[model samples]
Target: MMMKNVSLLLFLIFATSLSFAQTDTLKVKTDTGNVKKDRKKVEFGPGKTHYAYAYFNFMFATPPEEGTDADIFYGKSHSISYGVRYRLKLAKFFAVGAGVNYTYYAWHFKQNDNKKIPTSIIYDKEKLKINALEADVFFRFNFGKNKKSPVGNYIDIGGYGDRNFSTKRQFTNYINDGNTTGYSDYTGINTGLNYMNDINYGAEFRAGYGSMLLFAKYRLSDMFTPEFKNEISSTELPRLMIGFEIGFHK
Candidate 1:
């Protein structure tokens, strides 16, 4: 009976040890899995922090003409603009951005039929240019739930108050006189006002790893100059512009 009791006691001790060992193994495995899950979460987060970026834009208006040959008369129309943007996080899905942009416009007009023109023609005998400059402060709205976008897309809307400060406006006029000559010394005048302020509204779509941006703007002011001639009248037209911006931002 004593031997039987001893054997029974030993058996109970062994079973208890086995049970404790199994519980310890399970606890260790659970802790290891939790640690691995935590590491993975730390390695890959939703997005990145907000950043300040310096931006530049070269914009061109759509050619007013349809025919390919007509494009030659319109000349090279382009604008160079540069600015800096500050992004302030207002919420998880929204941010406020303000920036300053300085823009320059280059308008060129070239002569097509030189041989059919007169030397005395008071029109553009050579290439002429108009330079327009503007300083603007803008507010931008960003679209996306996350700041760091894996899908790589954003939309921005902004407005700028701009001033055109230059002394000359470029001009080119075809000689209306009914004459034909191979050469003419007359060309268009570069005439500009002292200071003209205008307001512009624009929107931009950005994507492609920060290399592509499509933008459009409309100036709500009538770009006009007072005519010195008594018979001349004031000009009125809404300046419409649209272009693509291709560059990088860091």
Candidate 2:
């Protein structure tokens, strides 16, 4: 009977130990899952935070020709873009970001001089420029099975507001008779008043692989303001841009 009792006691002890061991194992797994669920951002590496970035871009616009008057012609040249952003990792795979940018827009045009007499006016050959300060807000998404890959892919979709602060035109024109009496000069014109809207709002999309990106922007607002519509009777179309963006993040 004592042997029987000893065997029973040993069995109970073994069972209790096994039960505690199983509980500990389950607890460990639960803790690990919690860690993954609560993680806010992708761990790129030590000191490689993705919350901030800077980029330089060269772009071109599809000039709007509709609002142009009978005498004004619009064409595009080169555009330079540079910006910096700050982002908040709201989830493991997503963030909301905002930043400021500067864009210099260059254009070429054949314009009829507004101030010159129509009878004497030949077309004015002009180089035009508008520069602005802009602000953007976006939601960025990160993807791919290999998050550690230095070359990766992501997407950013956002809206931007651009306020043109400067505008100028350099022109050369001869008489309508195609004679040799031509004049060339530089003039600072109010681009916002005569050609472009003072305020432009647009939608932007960027898809990136590594440090390179393809971007497209579409202006939702009219190219010219209400007051300027009468001046540029044919200039009411929206502007668009598609180009590449390259830079780095810190």
Model 2 C-alpha lDDT per residue in residues 102-203, reported as the tens digit of each score: 999776654454322111234445555778899999998877744544535679999999988886655564444544755444333434335556788889
Worst 10 residues of 1 by lDDT: 113-122
For each candidate in the order shown, give its overall lDDT on alpha carbons: 0.50, 0.68
Write the residue-wise lDDT of candidate 1 on 1-250 in tens digits. 9999999999999999999999999999999999999876654322333555666776665544322221223325666787766655555555555666677765444445322111123335333233344444444444544445432445556565556545344445454465576444444444444323233333443332344677776655444333311123233222445666643453
In model 2, the clashing pairs are 66-234, 67-234, 67-235, 67-236, 68-234, 68-235
Any idea what lDDT model 2 has? 0.68
Residue 219 of model 1 has an lDDT of: 59
* Top candidate by lDDT: 2
Cα-based TM-score, every candidate: 0.52, 0.64
Q: What is candidate 2's TM-score against the reference?
A: 0.64
The all-Cα superposition gives candidate 2 an RMSD in Å to the true structure of 9.6
Q: After superposition, how far is residue 224 of candidate 2 from its true place, in Å?
A: 1.9
